[model samples]
Target chain A: MIGWKQIPPGMVILEAGSALKIKTGSWRAAYKPRWIEENCIQCLLCWLYCPDNAVKVEDGKRQDFDYEYCKGCGLCALECPGKKGNKAIVMEEEVR
Target chain B: MVTPLNLKELSKKELRFTAGHRLCAGCAAPTVVKMILLAACDYPVVVASSTGCLEVSSCISTYTAWKVPWIHSAFENAAATLSGVESMYKALKKQGKIDKEIKFIAICGDGGTYDIGLQSLSGAMERWHDMLYVCYNNEAYMNTGIQRSGATPTYADTTTCPAGSVIPGKPQPRKDLTKIMAAHGIPYVAQAAPSHWPDLMKKVRKALEIPGPKFMNIFTPCNRGWRTRTDDAILLSRLAVDTCFWPLYEVEKGVVRVTYKPKEKKPIEEFLKLQGRFRHLFEPGREQLISELQRMIDENWERLLKEEEIFASKEEEKEEVVK
Candidate 1:
């Protein structure tokens, strides 16, 4: 999600903790996690293991990931409980 | 009063350290970082890393793996740098220039903590900096070609102390850096491993809550340096704890508590055999080294138990006096 457009060269970040402004979704190069809400048990293991905190959940239920920040680390997919059979969240190759 | 019922609510509230770093696939440092950051998520944190693998790998030139405010300066002075940062933050907050509660975390490896950065760390802790210092001790100088360090275990092969006919490996026992830090009489000192997430997480929360300098010597296994498969890092860490190679314990106000004790303490060979660094010890005529290693582990474990008992009885006596 962190693209060249959002970041300027010369390492000039004027404000402290300003990284929140930079959408790092563009950092995912090859793959992204595709969530199947129906199959999700809402265990939230994916949320805990997600390095990017990309797995979005609301009201104690699972939601679609915020691609605006996910770096395609595949940790969520790796930890997704549905991997045994349900396949709630799968890493699909990026079309880009 | 509110409590997180499950992992989902917990993540929503505090996900400080986001993933996607260049740390090796199975290395324990990233996990350790994640757990520690999550534990300290209640406060805004400024994390600083010494010139080590975690720094170089995570902060690659322009691209940074850190989601929060982070700084990387030199190999030996992360504590000093963060001390300055904490001092400045305190000053700014007092002057009304800054208004948020910020916690400081200094991260380093064994090379930095047990050797190069000892003076800086001691000075910072002695001066009573309101910071948490974490040493991801992988035993050797893992960032610099796996050279032996002050924290290296005896009879382990390293670049500087390679196993050969002349010498088996490193000649000396590791310095008890945790006890040394405890000697400073800071609020908290602990030894933890990534394999025990709940224990490590608890310690992190406790450390950050304490009002002064706190230190955690975490066993971060290095797949590359230990010459083990990348996926075996966590397994090795668990073995390290079970075999008493890295005891799980904490010291608070001079009170020693052994956090985890294996039901059947696995022999040190169970741990050493997993790594190629100790492969030479299993060779012909070198079986003696294995027993020696076991003897050392047994002695240390016994000493730790005695210390804990002495402190526990002392506390009981104090309570009796109060009654």
Candidate 2:
């Protein structure tokens, strides 16, 4: 698993450093896409469209996203075609 | 007429554009941009915009509503070009060439923010430049005739993601760009809809106050794209927030707080049903998409609550130590 320390500088890292601050308060939030393996067709669309190379593949199949630098833009879910009977990719909210 | 109580009240009365700007009747972008300018009235603002509906309508070379300094760049490079303008401003400030405090703002559509301009947006935000980036998200690329964009909601029918015999409309959900901006660790990031004028104004003021990069993603409705009534833009914005589809909140210094939480959250269908883009989702088998959308909202609300609890507890601990 890639940790916060593993993120390289100049890269867009999700859930790293301080939470986004506004005038009202801070938000310790992270955007991560959940993969439902049962629904995945091994289409590899999620891996192909991820802007930050956050998704990984194993044995020529889709794997989990490496959140270390995943900006959680939800492009993977947007691009994933395995969303018919069961949505293979879903955007989830995580509190840091 | 009686004099106004504040500058804001007075500025509203003296708009440069009378009423005949080329923007569609229900377009929320023009109003949001006006609000931003009103809030940042303290500084000399230079606006760099992308080739979207807003730019196309306001800037026709010979005639324009942009009274302040402005430039219309390509669809994908407003952020990058604005970064250059900001750098030049800084150098000029140090050399005493430009002594005034000038604010730089980059305005773009969803196509620019989530698709073509994503790289430039990242570059500008990463550089920690003193600027405010506003994404006037109308959900699709309306300037190009209602094409699908990364910001379009799930299951919504667009020209690109149209429902066909083999496939339903846009099968995937909208991109969570707010979370993406927050991950950059910028000083300010928030989502505002023009329907909530007070909230949008407050966030704009806060973003201007921040010394580092600030990003505000505003949900502007498009009558042309969504196939809605021309006068329903404000109503649509209000419904979006009231239904919990678009929560009104802000994140400050790593603490997440809800600015406005509905006492009784309305059904998501109320907001979805108004727009024709989501018409297909109301059909059979597509019911699952609605449930999934609800689940996503619920998940986000739960996470927001947990964040508040953690931060509140930490504050309580600090208070106990003080005692």
Candidate 3:
């Protein structure tokens, strides 16, 4: 730990976006959302609603989850308005 | 009408509010933050957040969830914090010290916004600061363990005002914060929900472009405080809008505009039943409470529509006079 005098000006961490290094995906103790690519209509609601920004999207189309930071809130699966019984994203138990 | 919002193109913008930090699972605050940042993506941004969940969780010591410049403010002075920053920016720009355009935002949960920071907010708005004040209204003080706040809806059970056999939940109606901000007669005041991203983005964009104080009361559901499933924040937000419990509307220059009108307005039960905070309201003999809450919502909705009809034509008249 740095001394008070050694701390950056206003204690502001000079490095921007430093939180990306913290692997918050460990917070997901149980369920992890599985993105079934074929079922995705690419509405981007999952992308929009992910609290962690874990849903990886490119060019408006659905891609995969950045599990390193996902936190496995299962929000993507819960809000996916896919065809009945064949939702785009579904929660699976983390086999730890 | 404002230009069409292209979601596909917008999806490609750099994520200003990045991953990691300690916000609770299914926390709607991050989604709200992301939406606001995305809307203001075209410019460099500086955010001042009051001492609340977003501040406590997202920016802990050396780690920060924000990619852009960020400042943490006191519980009752986020508006003041941003106000000072904006004034400095203006001064520096005039002296040619800063060359780029930067957007300013003050964020707070309902705890700070509807109660603690209200005075500062009013003062800043009255002073016409070139900043946007966004309140992510989860309806209670969730970070402090779901205590009842001024924004907590009528009779919704909270830790401070827990429902029991003797007395049911919170005694007072939820404060109409958006309406109060509108009464300030600022350039823009809006009540949006994170569920409707397009409407929210549009409002944020419009608010930033207008060179005066703007306020947005965004309905962000708390999965923990509301005793909901971890994933229900977005849907609960949607239900809040559909039931008129939290209307999606904006008051631009004192003229009200309801953003999205549900083809069939859902009943308050649909919204209340989804959350455990309102579980007591549905119990036997508590039917009166439900009806009373419904009546309150209906009255507010009617008043908003009436205001829209009255002032909408007047807005057109102002435009005509300008032409």
User: What are the clashing pairs of model 3?
Assistant: none
The sequence of per-residue lDDT tens digits that candidate 2 reaches over residues B42-160 is 66688888889888776543445566677766888898889889999999889989888788888889999999889889889999989999999999999989999999887778899
Q: Rank the candidates by lDDT, best first.
A: 3, 1, 2
- lDDT by residue (tens digit), candidate 1, B1-323: 23333465565664555444556544667767877887776777899999888887776535566767887778889999999999999899999999997889988888989999999999999999999999999999887799999999999999999999999999999999999999999989999987777788889888888888999999988877998854456678889999999999999998999999999999888898889999999999999999999999999999999999999999999999999
The pairs that clash in candidate 1 are: A1-A23, A1-A24, A1-A25, A1-A26, A1-A27, A2-A24, A51-B19
Q: What lDDT score is found at residue A53 in candidate 2?
A: 38
Find the 10 residues in a row with the least total lDDT in model 2 chain A: A19-28
Q: Worst ten-residue run, lDDT, model 3 chain B? A: B1-10
- Predicted candidate 3 versus true structure: per-residue lDDT over B109-192, tens digit per residue: 999999999999999999999999999998999888999999998888999999998678999888888889999999999989
State the lDDT of candidate 3 residue by residue for A17-80, as single tens digits: 8888888999998999998888878778888889999988887777899999999888889889
Candidate 3 vs. true structure, TM-score: 0.95
What are the DockQ scores of the candidates, in order? 0.19, 0.01, 0.79
Q: Write down the RMSD of candidate 1 (Cα, Å).
A: 4.9
Q: Pick out the ten consecutive residues of candidate 3 chain A with the lowest summed lDDT.
A: A1-10
Off by over 4 Å in 2: A1-96, B1-19
Positional deviation of A75 in candidate 1, in angstroms? 10
| Interface C-alpha root-mean-square deviation of candidate 1 | 5.0
